[model samples]
Target chain A: MNLTILGCYAATPRTFTNPTSQVLEIRNRLFLIDCGEGTQVQLRKNKIKFSAINHIFISHLHGDHFYGLIGLISTFNLLNRNNDLTVYGPKGIQEIIKLQLKLSNSWPQYDLHFVELTSTESEIIFEDDKVIVKTIPLKHRVYTNGFLFQEKIKERKLNVNAVQNYEIETCYFQNIKSGKDITLEDGRVIPNSELTFDPEAPKSYAFCSDTMYNEEIIPIIKNVDVLYHETTFLESEVELAKKTMHSTAKEAARIALQANCKQLILGHYSTRYESIKLFKEEAQTIFENAVLGDDGKVFEL
Target chain B: MNLTILGCYAATPRTFTNPTSQVLEIRNRLFLIDCGEGTQVQLRKNKIKFSAINHIFISHLHGDHFYGLIGLISTFNLLNRNNDLTVYGPKGIQEIIKLQLKLSNSWPQYDLHFVELTSTESEIIFEDDKVIVKTIPLKHRVYTNGFLFQEKIKERKLNVNAVQNYEIETCYFQNIKSGKDITLEDGRVIPNSELTFDPEAPKSYAFCSDTMYNEEIIPIIKNVDVLYHETTFLESEVELAKKTMHSTAKEAARIALQANCKQLILGHYSTRYESIKLFKEEAQTIFENAVLGDDGKVFEL
Candidate 1:
């Protein structure tokens, strides 16, 4: 799994900082999340192909989260994209995008689908043979949701030498990989564990941003390989963070520590802060594996 | 009059080139025109204060023309801007912006006014004591208008030496500046021309963009001091220009020549070109004063 941060600032897009947008590549599929203003330009700067984005997940209706949706959709139409595109966002997202397209008279030729999300509970939004995507309800000033991407457990790997030594037929190889015992022609049964090895553990990632310090999300994102949480402020500004329905760095770290996430990525920093390293320092006080999420930062897990 | 080209490319914004957006400073008031995506960042890069802009003129509803508007407005609210903002655009612009704001639940604290335009004829849209802004109707894929910013004729300058020599009272200075002859206490009428010199000729600038080669705007923009015209394509791609309802470089030059504009600024070049200098070469073949308009390029007229 690979994750690319296209933007990781708060409020508005600045000359050197962007609002909030990221690309998560899992099982060779790219999923976009929280397309803030200037996302397309950020994509260009990062050399990410526009055609690779098939699914976009928005956290909320805030401009800092989804203002770039209409422009990105319009660019897709201008490029003559024909593949189907799906957007998973807040309830009013479809209306906002469709209204702009209608006014511009530049509807997409491709199939554009919207899954308007209003659910306040964790529920699967996308599922396939290799991966599953579920929503993590978040507390914010508006209706918002974070997404959890989990890779499905893979089939057991065949131990070729062990299988050949056991005289397992080709037909029985499939059963052995499926964790089933193999039956020989001599009416002897061979244990599946003797012919196959356990597959690598699956990885999971949870993205939560633009939310307050709410512990209710811990249950939904527990034991994730990686957790990206918003650190819009430092502990010094904890009061402001709470008043504005945002989380401070220490608060995000506390949530990560309680949730048992392997690694914590801090992002959506308020532009008022002089340096983002301060957030990492503050988060590290609670979680040892806390790291700063800067624009264009890439992580391979 | 000062004109700053925040973005001048056509179609979609790229890694280096931007879409259509500019700032026109007339009589010390900044007027934003055609805010494409990434405009706020561009404004920041150019050091143009967001608070200085009180009026925005959108030529059309095309995404390349006005997609950045909603984000800019939202940023204004975030910045706590308290000044009034007026937008003049096509009839549906108000609905489009208001709908986004409503969905985001981020209504502006300042008074937001919209002047929806539906007229196909040229008419005055903004007027003040020092300047007059009139729409120059243009033919495009959508309802479009080019803006003509004419600096209203200034009052005659006071000849300080001549006035003092005549011992003109301060109370009569206003009348003298208004081109009224001064009458001495002895009933001797002083000629207005002798007391004051003519002010510098009022300058004018017309912004024409996203329009095809049409002569209908000649009367409206005739004899303008400077004209910024869209040159989306070179003469070699005239066919595509017609199909897209965009003007070619030579075509823009032809319009400038026919309109008798003193200087022609060519902008909105298609990103397909390897060099923007070709546009200037082609435009200058038809009009001597034609110049290329680049992102961040400023013009003082």
Candidate 2:
């Protein structure tokens, strides 16, 4: 799985920094997360194919998180995109998009679907054969939810040496990969575990932003391979972070530690800071595996 | 008056070109015209002061014309702007804006006033002491209007030698500048024409875009000092222009010529062609004083 940070600044779009937006590619499927203003331009600048994005996950209704969605949808129609697009977001997103389309007298030629989240409890929002996505209920000033993308477990890998010596029938190879015991033509029972090894561990990523530090979410995102959490403030601004419902770098690190995530990615720095190194330093004091997210940066898991 | 082109290309925004948006500075007031997508970035790249633009004029509800407006407004709120902002646009613009704000849960601290236009006939939309803005109805896919910004006639320059020789009273100077014959306290009468010339012929600029070639608007924009019109297609693609209710370079120039505009500015070139210089060349066939609008290019009128 590969993750690309299209934008990671807090508050507003400036000459050097942009608002929140990113792309997560898992099993060749592109999923857009938190489309802030100027996101389409960032997509173009990064050479990401606009048409490849079929699913969009919006964390909240905040303008900084999803203001660019309408324009992106309009542009897709202008480009004659015919593929159906699915959008999962908090309630009221559909109304916002519909109003703009009505005022403009333009409608998409393709099917547009919206899955509005009105529930405060965690639930599976999207699922397919290869991946499953669930909501991570977060504490914020408004109703908001983070996303957790987890890759599904795959078939076991064949052990060539064991298969050669166990007199395994070629027809039973499928059963062996499925972790089933099979009887060969020689009337000998073969154990699937002896002929095949377990598949590579599934990778998972958790995304949280615009939320205060909450340990209640630890169980939902525990043992995630990678965790991207907003660190809007440094240690010096903990009071401000709490007041604004934002997390300081130290607080973000504490969440990552409690969740026992393999790695931690910090983003959504306030526009007041000139550099994000301070955030990294603050996070590192509590969690060793902390990295800062900047515009156009990418990570592979 | 000075005009800065933030974006002038037709169709979708790309890495090299942007959609319709511009900045017009008249009498120290900055007016943003037609904010397309990515306008905030364009404004930043051009180094425009965001706080200075208190007035925005949207010609139509098309996404290419005002898709970036919500994002810009949200940015203003995020920046904690307290100044009042006035937006002039089509009748349904208020609903679109209000819906977005409602969904985003963001409210600006500043006062935002909207002047909705439903008239199909030419009318004065804005008027200040130094400038007057009138709407010129145009034929398009949607209800649209072109804007005509005319600078008010300036006070006549004092002819010091003539005033001294004629022994004109100081109080009579105001009447003379108002283009009226004035009599001094000593009973000496002076002809206004003999004392002062016409106030430098008030300069006017007419902006017409996303419309087909129509001669009906000539009277409303007649004798404009500078005319900026959309030329979405070249001579070779004139058929496309007619089909899309857009105009070709030659067609735009024809309107400028029929209106007797002093100079013609061609813009909103379709993304099909790479070179915008062709628009100027094609327009110059009928209007010699024609120029192409490029991003960041400024024109003084």
Candidate 3:
């Protein structure tokens, strides 16, 4: 799985910094997360194929989080994109996009679908054969949710040397990979484990932003391969963070440590900070695997 | 009056070109016209002071004309702007903005006033001591109108040298500047023309875009200092222009010529043509004073 960070700043978009937006490529599928303003430009700069993004996951309806969605959709129409696009966002997102289209008197030629999430409880929002996405209920000033993308386990790999020694038929390899014992022509039962090795462990990523420090999401995002948490403030601004329903770097780090994530990506830094090194330094005090998220940075898991 | 072209290209926003948008500075007042997508970034790149823009005039509800408006308004709120902002546009703009604000659950701390235009005939939308803004109804697919910004005639010059030479009292200078006959303390009648030269002639700029070839608006925008008209296509694509309710360069220049404008600024060129020189060349065939509008290019009228 590969993750591309298109933008990873907090609040308003600046010349150097952008609001939250990212692309996760898993199992040959591209999933867009939190498309903020100027996301299409960022996507162009990152050299990502616009049509490859089939699904969009919006965490909330905040302007910085999803203002670019309507523009992007309009651009797709202008470019003559015919593929169906699925948008998973908060309840009001569909209305906003519809209003824009109505006012402009422009409609897309492609099939546009909206999956509004009105549920307050944690649940699976999207699922396919290889991937599953769940919502992580978060505490914020408005109704907001984090996304957890978990890749499902794959089929067991064939043990070539073990298969050679055992006169295994090529036609039976499929059964063996499916973790089933196959009986050979010699009337000998062979164990599936002896003929095949275990499949590689699936990786998972959790995206959380614009939320206060909440331990309630720990169980849902526990032991994630990577966790992107918003650190909108520093240690000195803990009071401000609480008041704004945002998390400080130290608070994000504490959540990362509690979740036992292998790697912690700190993002959504307030515009007040000139540099994000302080957030990394502060997060690392509690979680050694903490890293600062920057625009255009990509990660492979 | 000075006009700064933020973006002039038609249709979609591109890497090197932009959609329709411009800033007209008249009498120290900045008026933003037709804010397309990416307008805020263009404004930042141009180093325009945000606070200086007190009024925004949108030509129509087309996406290429006003897509960036919501983002600009949101940014103003994010910056904690307390000054009142006045937006003038066609009917339904208020509902669009209000819906966005409602979805985001954010109401600006400052007052946002909207002046919706429903008049099909020429009507003054905004007027002050220094400037007057009137709408010039146009033919288009949607409810559209062009804006005419005319700087009011300046107050007569004090004629400091004449006043001192004529031994005129300072109190009577106001009357002299107002073109009134002033009676001096010495019982001498001073003609206003002798005391002061004519004030600077009123400069007018007419912005007509996203409209078909319509000569009906000529009388409304007659004898304007500068006329910016949309030339979405070349003469070769006149059919497409008619189908899209747009105008060709020659057609736009013809309208400018009929209006007897001092200068014609050709803009809103279709993205198909890479070079805008063709637009100017074609327009010059009809109007010799025609010039191509370019992004970031400024014109003084």
lDDT per residue (tens digit) for residues A170-238 in model 3? 888888888999787889988888998889999999999879999999999999999999999999999
For model 2, the local distance difference test gives: 0.90
Evaluation by DockQ, superior candidate among 2 and 3: 2
Better by TM-score, candidate 2 or 1: 1
**Model 3: per-residue lDDT, tens digit, B55-120?**
999989888888888888999988889899999999989998888888888889989999998889
Q: Which predicted model would earn the best TM-score?
A: 1
Q: Mind giving the per-residue lDDT tens digits that candidate 2 earns over B1-301?
A: 8999999998777877888999999888899999998898899899899999998999999988998899899888877898999999999898888877876668788999999998999999889999999988989998998899989989997777888888777878887888888776778777777788767878888999889999999999999999999999998998988898999999999999999999998899887887888899999999999998998899988
User: Candidate 1's residue-wise lDDT over B3-33, tens digit each?
Assistant: 9999999888888889999999988989999
Ranking 1 against 3 by TM-score, winner: 1
Considering lDDT, which of the candidate structures 1 and 3 is the better prediction for this target? 1
Model 3, stretches more than 4 Å misplaced?
B161-166, B183-190
Worst 10 residues of 3 chain B by lDDT: B10-19
Regions of candidate 2 where Cα sits further than 4 Å from its true position:
A185-187
Residue B136 of model 2, lDDT score: 87
- Give one digit per residue, the lDDT tens place, for model 2 in A155-213: 99989899888767677788888889877777888777888898999999999988999
Ranking by DockQ: 1, 2, 3
Q: Provide the lDDT at A243 for model 1.
A: 93
